[model samples]
Target: MVTERLSMRNMTKTYGTNTVVKNVNFSVLPGEVHALVGENGAGKSTLLNMLSGVTMATSGEIFVDGEKAVITKPTDARDYGIAMIHQELQNIPELTVFQNMFLGNPKTKGGVFVDKDREAKRAKEILFELDPDIDPWEKIKNLKVSQQQIVEIARALLANAKIIAMDEPTSSLTPQEFDRLAQLISDLAKKGVSVIYVSHKMDELFRVCDRATVMRDGQYIDCVNMKDMTEESIVTMMVGRKIEKVSHHSYVTDRVMLEVENLGRVGTVKPASFKVHAGEVLGISGLVGSGRTELFRLIFGLDKPGLAVAKHTRMSREIAGLDKPANGKVIVKGESIKLNDVHEAIRHGIGLVPEDRKLEGILKSRSININMGMPSMSKYTKGGFIKRGFLRKKSYEIMKGLNLRPLDVDRAIGTLSGGNQQKVIIGRWLASGTEIFLFDEPTRGIDVGAKSEIYDAIEELAKQGKAILVISSEMPEIIRISDRVMVMRDGEIVAQLEGEDINEATIGQYSIGQAKKQTEAVL
Candidate 1:
């Protein structure tokens, strides 16, 4: 019998009355890239945690090179040649790239002084292997998310780990960075390093993985060779049933719901122009620094643009100074108004689901009920008294509608998973009765089943006459949900596509600046 590099048999983890991972049997051969996939709460993370010694398994037999092993803590896992890069970047932002890479394990000379020069040289070598352009002396805080991810990969390699497990590592990466990562994984496999890759991106999994293990409701389903399995079959094993692809018929109307003309920030964004109808989903696709988020910030009134003009379909009152057209004009219904701030924009029936959810969407310490109710408190207020009962009732309804698990409104939102936290943020906006929704990376860091649910929710809102805008880095996401797609590159909108033109190839062509422009570009 051939000995596996890493193997687990009947691995089970339970907390109180709940079993998060149930008798999961998995293994990986040397030089193989194995994918671990499942819906949210399907035990993928839990299984990985056990292998990495972040959490102990209740019952299991772990083997390394045909020998039984014990992994009781992180140090034990490291000693056993195991390493993990979590979904979130975990690094000291103030430290330089080289400093962060060698922070815990420093090179020493003669077992006395630290070998700073040797450490820096080694760090540079590892960094160059991942991305030759990255500066080793640059601070982690200054690096983009994609750059930081590469740094994490370098750190794992510096540890000389035989097995590395990566969780959603490409969630924040650009197309170029992802390509580099794919090549890196291929090279690592050639070096006899086993990789356990976890990602919700189907295209990426099929491209890189040789085999995949699917889990559902905390139990192992089946492991299939990539050559023999299709995306549909893998998804079926994950969800235990079939989920139809989300399709949207164009709901565009001649009546403009939101319009921006000449909205430009001096050094940041250029003169951007676009219009959304009462029920259309306008998808914005771009590279990392393409100013898609910046344009959205200007429209949402989070950033002051040097030149701006915006219009909405609903407003509380007619905005002043529409005749001057100083920063552009925002017209709702038939009256022009100025959305100079977020409150003003919200008051005019516009809502923004910010890209950084934890920073801008929810308060981690607050209860789910409070987080959901805080945005629309006026509805539950009477004179000087706050209606706690009404607020609780509304929060409950929102939870039920969004299918939030555990259903405990009193629990802190921080205790929930990534997908559940997103639902709370979306539910908060729904409670406010906003007519126009702007979602930034709505399915980012979320699982496949949850992604489907969010897609359905977005389409349902469009069907109900609510205009929606989506900014996504994933090409599949842009093609699946967008009725019309606008591709941005280097702070400018280079191409716009609609109908059958919104496939991966067309989006890729435009995103990489290959599409010829017919008119002046806008960012």
Candidate 2:
């Protein structure tokens, strides 16, 4: 008989007037990988935070190994053998991997002076279990994102945690690293440690979990064995409805809005090329570690495509036998121009909604007014000085356009929900007068209601002839908005589907780098 390791009864959480988590009941059995998945702000993280004692539950009782437990603080959680790895990593950059792993529980000599050598040895042993490739002496700052995650996991295991929860642990990890994590979860489960895996990625959950618990708008929706469901079915349950099949509207025009000729970033992104016309959204998709990001990074001038050199052979012989696409225009409106940088990409009608919003998108300290005013500040600033009054008024205008709630210009940007924060970023660029928008995972951490709003925003942009480039992990999203789709694999445009050709299965195939020969081609 399977025994429950952890259980939460009538778990509820509220923030002032907002009820984020509501009467949620959940359980994790010993040696089970129980997955919790939902759109961002659906209360998944809130419940985890409550269980980990990072935040107090408004009303609830927790049972550990059938014994009622009290966790008022993080230390209480630690003592109860409950550990969590947050989406955003928190490690002292200056500390060594060994030191960070044994942070709070330091060894003491004669119960007074610290014993560094002994702690380092124990830390090393823990790292060996989590990831043998990581060096104990390496500085925490020097580790890759994935390695840093491993260090966090090692730190959790060091506590001898019976229940370890990973919150989007693979968000920054490579595909190989994610596979490694799957195995590590399996290994942890085998050792009788109940693991709670929280992620938005369907593929990862489907591959690894034994059972999945879903939440929606801060309420427990359902719990079911992984074997009894498909990804589509799981998503349907989480969202509370069937997601209609994505249809591509066929009135595509050949007037190319953007064209990349022989774009290259050697080793990172090969000399790749593609074109996107007005009303068409080219979707660049790939497994983690593939250079989908690099290809766009160069195009947006964050990095050069190395085409300025006079020697490299680039483009076909027909376009004047040029060694590269240098001196050739990325031509918007037949105007030969240079993108000063990413900002210039927007100035000339391009806005990129980056994949990792927490890192590249959100500005926590500023208010909604300041955030939206940033990209397009000409109306609010004069001779390098900003006019606060003007900017505040303009912020309201942008908010009204996006139909943002609360309409509070004075509130700090971080206080808003994930979807609202995303809208603020988009609002900034729209104010910048950008005709083309590059949206990378526009709905990543947002909830279902917010997702519908964002999709409407995308369609609205397209109707205004705003050429949008959307790179998304969500297949339904890629299929829903893109008038025509182009899939990227290993940093190259592997497949281009248009009009009657765009469908979930085909785009999905191209997304995972299998669009061509093993074709499940459908319209």
Candidate 3:
């Protein structure tokens, strides 16, 4: 019989009267890449938290190397050779890569002062093993999201961790970066390290994981071999039902609701033009740092817009504008509106669901009702007093419409899963009567089931004749939901694809400038 490297018998967790994680059994073999997958609120996070010593299990027996281990704190887990890398990284942005790597426990000289040379040397060695391009002397703030993730992994490796659990590791990675990460995981497993990989991306799980443990509604379902299961089968096991593939239909109308002419930001976004119809979903696709988010910020009035120097001469000649050659103009409902700030954008009926939901989107400490009604508070208030009853009723109605889990408007938004928190953000805009919606990485870090729900909501909004603009890193998501796609490269829109032209291959080529090079060659 093969002895498991780690095992949890009948693990359970509870808070007051509510049990978040029911009795479940899990085990991982040495050098095995195991997958822990489920929908949001399905107890995957709770289980991992227990294993990593973030939370204590109410009832469970943890065995490491066939010996019982009592891990009550993060230090204990670290001592037991276990590490957890959360989706939201724990590195200090102000510190250098090596400093962040040795944040808690640093190499010391004479047991007093930190040995800077020794720390840097060890950090460089581990970081180089993962990605040689990562400079240990560089500040964490200057590094990309993928590079920051590698630093976290290198830190764990430096600590001689035998088991590492990563949550949504590839959520921010580009295809090339993901490939590198996949290779690193394979290497780690070869070195007798156990990896508990958690993600909503099915293709990734199938590629890197050898076996998968499925959970639903806090209950243990079953563990299955990766080769024996299909995406559809695994999804069914997660959701307890077969989810039908949503067929996207064009809802575009002839009436253009939003139009951008010569929209540009100096040193950021290049001069670009496009139009979104009243009932259309336009997707912006590009590699990281392609100005997709910057464009959205300009449109939403979060940032000031400026003309690219190269376009000023030509644009000045085309449009005879008096005041210093206006960089761009935003037209809504056939009227040019000055979007000077976020309030101006909101007044013009534009709502944005920002990419970093936890940071910019929602007030985590507030209740779901408060978050849902925040943007439209005036509508739910009278005579300097909040209409609590009316607000709750409206919030509950919207939550029900969005299929929010638990259906409790009074619950703290922070306590909810990523999917439900996203629903609250969408519900807020709906209450504000937003006409044009801008979703940035709308489904990022959410589960597959929640992704379907979000797609449905976008479809419904489009069907209602509301103009929608989406910026996403996922190519398949762009192809599946977009009526048209705008591919950006180096802060410029390179290709605008529609219908059959919006596949992964076409987007890939355009995103990397291959299509542009080919076109230039032909010209």
Candidate 4:
């Protein structure tokens, strides 16, 4: 058996009253790919953070090669031959690939004078040694997400990492790029490097990992070899119960509230067409970067489609006579108007819950009330004057309805945790009185306990006659909440499943181009 290179026994992490990860015990053996997986907010990120020295384990012991090693910080872990690749890109976007590769550790030509030429040469050699496709002198900001991932792996190898923890590395990678990465991981295993891979995708785990560890709600459940398990069994273990198999949700709406006849963006979401009725949830389920988010952005006026994938036709306006070639009009109710304008969209009762909540959802400097009540300021303020009392009073009402912890209107929103911050943003739109809501990865970065609350709120909104369009990577969420599922691949809406067809395996098959409209499903 390969010897254990790193061990975390009785690992736990806590913030305030919530325990993010608890009593987790695992080992990474040399020359093996150990996949760590669970649902979103099931403590995978916290566990990886503990191992990577980004966060010190609250109460645990870490052993390196059978010796107790101190890893109170990131530098200490690097000293012990441990490295990590974050889920969110960590490289400096302004810096070149070479500069980022040798950021902290640079070659000195004359004791103090830095040798940039030699540093770039060494960086190129490292990248070539691994992938050879990524150029070291190119600016990191100019590269796609896949190329950035390759650069990160090359840097880890250059540091001579014995234990590497990767958090959802393939989330942004294309199929061909993923295949190359899987092979590279195998090659690294052959060289005796232990790889700890974290992901929620089941197919990738079965293909790439030697053994797997399953965690649920911050607790470690089991660690078993890949050969001994199936996807259903692993999911059952991780979730602690069998998820009831449900077909698609049946919708009873005939009122076409939002119509997209030919909606599209060039090289992004194709000319896509779909109709959503009031009180219905339309789910677009696909892998990351499958243009699920891109499609919704166009509908909400966040971006104008360069090309139309689908166009809408109404009784009043001619679809062919539309000025925009990229796509036709996004019609609300009976009138057809251009959806490519920001002010027009919100005025027409449309609200968007963005994917990156930290960057886009809530304002950092604003108060909780301001974050929640800013959507429709006219309702709370007087004519060309301040109306502070009404704003705070209204914001508190929405926060209470959402079950936010403190319901403190005066508190700065940035001080709250991720879950509470998400509530603030949701509450913001809920106050807007929008008829159509587009939510992209609505429950990301929040804890498991909060996810249930968020889902309940979404269900409430749908039941209240809102046309909801949801884009989520997690298949289970799509199945549990959506009234209809639209499977996308390569920026095209390949299949639309109504009642009795939305299964996780079926969605995966469609998203990967494995199963099509004509082909029978393997599962």
Point to the candidate with the largest TM-score: 3
lDDT (tens digit, per residue) of candidate 1 on 172-286 = 8887888878999999999999999999999899999999988988999998998898888888789888878756666666677887776666445655677788888999998
TM-score of each prediction: 0.91, 0.81, 0.95, 0.76
Candidate 2 RMSD computed on C-alpha atoms after optimal superposition onto the true structure: 5.1
Model 3 agreement with the true structure over 1-523: per-residue lDDT tens digits: 8779899999999999999999999999999999999999999999999998999999999998898989888988998899999988999999999999998999999999999889989998998779999888899999999899999999999889999999999888898899989999999999999999999999999999999999999989999999999999999999999999988988899998898877877767766678899889999999988999988999989888874344556555344221245578888888887865888788789999999999999999999999998878999899989899999999999889999998999999999889889999999999988999999999999988999999999999999999999999998899999998988888778888888888999999989878872231100
Report the C-alpha lDDT of model 4 over 53-123, residue by residue, as the tens digit: 88988899899888898888888888888999887878999989988887777788887987889988888
- Scanning candidate 3 in windows of ten residues, the lowest lDDT window is 514-523
Best by lDDT: 3
Candidate 2 lDDT, tens digit per residue, 185-280? 899899999999987677888888999998988999999999999977988888888876434453345677887666665556655556676766
**In candidate 2, how many Å is residue 327 off?**
7.3
Q: Mind sharing the TM-score for model 3?
A: 0.95
Backbone clashes in model 3, listed as residue pairs = none
Query: Which runs of model 2 end up more than 4 angstroms from their true locations?
Result: 1-3, 15-19, 108-117, 228-243, 262-272, 287-291, 303-329, 380-411, 448-453, 473-523
Clashes of 4: 15
> What lDDT does each candidate get?
0.83, 0.77, 0.90, 0.80
Candidate number with the higher TM-score (1 or 2): 1
Q: Give candidate 2's TM-score.
A: 0.81
Query: In lDDT terms, how accurate is model 3?
Result: 0.90
Q: Spell out the clash pairs found in candidate 2.
A: 349-435, 349-436, 351-438
